[model samples]
Target: MSVISDVSIPPARTAAVSRRFYITAWRWHFYAGLYVAPFMLMLAVTGLIMLWTATISGRDGEKIYSVAPQASLAPVSAQAEAAFGEVAGQIVQYIAPRTAEQASLFRVNQGDASYMVAVDPYTAKALGHWDRRNGLYDLADSIHGTLLIGDVGDRLIEIAAGFGIVLVITGLYLWWPRDNSGFSSVLVPQLSAKGRQLWKSLHLSIGFYVSLILVVFLLSGLTWAGVWGEKFTQAWSTFPAEKWDNVPLSDLTHASLNYNGVKEVPWALEQTQMPASGSQAGISGTPEGQPVTLDAIITLARALGFDQRFQLGFPASETGVWSISRDTMSNDSANPLHDRIVHIDQYTGRILADVGFADYGLAGKAMAAGIAFHEGDMGLWNLVLVTAFCLAIIFLSVSGFVMWFKRRPRGATRLVAPTVSEPGPLWKTGAIVMLGVSLLFPLSGAVLVAVLLLDLLVIRHIAPLKKTLS
Candidate 1:
């Protein structure tokens, strides 16, 4: 929607105010774009690679096999044994195929490294194996998440995303069609226009189209950020351990279920405490004669309607329960509403806790659905839509750079940012709003404060710096 429109105002009274507001927004937009453009391009490129690779070759090389489905498939126990035998590591997790044509995947840990063993369900033979976190898709994911610089990169990206919101806001303010510009300027790019005008038109039109999607992506990605995500949003939105009735809690939380730098726990349960297995505190899901084995657990899972690409995480400690989960995060189900997690006692094979989407709180539910939509895990259309949005982001970022280059005088070393005039009441109000945003996102707020200090103390004070920036 347009942020500004033509209105009847006496030029003598409102022209200066409108001009000042527009200039302020344009200045913020320009500076934010200068900082955020690179990260936006990186995220879009890496995100596209991740999406296609995840859909085609599959993460952890799970799609490398092409075995014909047999009339009868090997038992789950035999498949697990075959995978374990091939990898020569402790079996930590089992991923059942979503369909008969797909291969069974097993997560094996040998000492420090973790590997995924893909097995043909028909023959119970290990098809191939690869490093779970080093595969092509996982590599893209690592870069997407942390830029390969770990926590430092994470904070930088988080700050970029926060500023990205500012960029969108200020961008909308600058883009809002006024006077007789009409739908042509808002909906379609004027390819007939040349140089900066054409670039500006394309950028504005494309940016407007993808603005909502970008915001969604930014918010969803923020939920995984270290400080704001882990400490603030996810901390409060997490599922409560009190839902487990009288069961004793383990020292470990559901975050422990995420393996090899991959998040596997349902978004809602990541911060919830894991229930211990020793107590006879749960209903028996296993049959009377059956012992608590991988096969028995499979049977129990199947009985509970986990027939698709559900995952099973073996207990890592003495008190840990076997985790059976099916969620959109793992691409197990397209419908986030069907997300489920069940913890079973490894000793007694009793179902300790069963959580479904319905059990989630309001925030948990929104995050669950938002994450699924963010990852394009909901359906084929979702993937296509997200891909188009990524392309739009890349185009907008590039066009912005092109427009800046064209606007700058030849051989100029200056940043050529918009000139800032003395602050008016409206400008002060806008600054206060930005400060409020900074308070909401601490990292971005800190960066904003630093930029303000630099601008006021250094850029505005020094003649050369002032000439360069203004």
Candidate 2:
């Protein structure tokens, strides 16, 4: 497993083309790896931490709310009353208890501060309170998603993810078994090999196995990214506005309800208009004479088969609706096919809309399943698989850095990056790929162009890079 060696090319006319593409692949693989390695390492480490914490303490502060099961539990309103008393504020949302031994959660807003108030369902006593999203897992998640710096972090991560995809493509090409190399070299690390061979063997074998799964993980994770996911894909894949049956829509969308970077609603409904409460046309929701209180909404939610764990969001404004929903992102449901959100008019207490897995567009539906798989929320099996993949990513990141360190031109302090051996038709094809990546991920594409321009404008004229691409 030597670098820049394609002894696999036999007596064939396209050997030149094949050889040129191989070097092209190697060059870009090297380039993408340099930029993507650190980001990938951070993603894997934080992802594993989040997973471990989720497994041990629970994703939604369940440890703070764990309670002893009782013969009879308190009413939902009593729990809300207790939570309000503890927080001394309005209960903006409620997450129902998943099981008998778990207490319910209420999001209370007291002035400018918000808190997650945990109440024991059996006795309707305030169990505890924590500032919303102030836990260790939440901090790790914030970094994992946006690096805790908002939209700029989001764009940086999106570009990293895009380059991550490029890494997979080019690495696979570089790892494609040459005629001289056996499948053993691709599948297994050779222990008998020493020094650079050992590192090369490990890096190649691990990169080959992890590349496919890594791409799936990256694409699924990118759905939450601001640029590629939201600006482009989500806009086209969202729930159809026409499905609302001419109901007067509110000025705000479901995205308005997602606070503190938490997705309280489904991905498909994020941009779709929230139905206004003033609309009179809707299916039966709350009882006709029942005053629409938090208790009434909870009662309606339970009756509508929203028992166990589900988020019930209070109306945000006069025209807003009481929202009840379960989605994988919220860690409420394991199965995306079972994901759904229902809106009830605040004034009329009628069902304004109910969007489920079936309502999602094709891409939306793919994202639904992909998101569940991405977060390892589907089940224990998925959790194990995602954890294993995270570990593999960490290994790849380390092995890649080791290989680069060992293989860099000896005695050279500056970069000695590999380049294609000769200028040929492959450059034209690569231009097409760069075009595709730029279009698919506009932000990352801009980065690719900038790097290319840097090479043309600066690197070539500089003292270091004129050594000619091998």
* Highest-scoring model, TM-score: 1
TM-score, every prediction: 0.95, 0.92
Instruction: Report the error of model 2 at residue 300, Å.
Output: 2.0
For residues 312-338, write the lDDT of model 2, one tens digit per residue: 888878887889998887888899988
Backbone clash tally (model 1): 0
Colliding residue pairs in candidate 1:
none
lDDT of each: 0.86, 0.83
lDDT, residue 342, model 1:
93
Candidate 1 Cα errors over 4 Å, as ranges = 1-9, 421-425
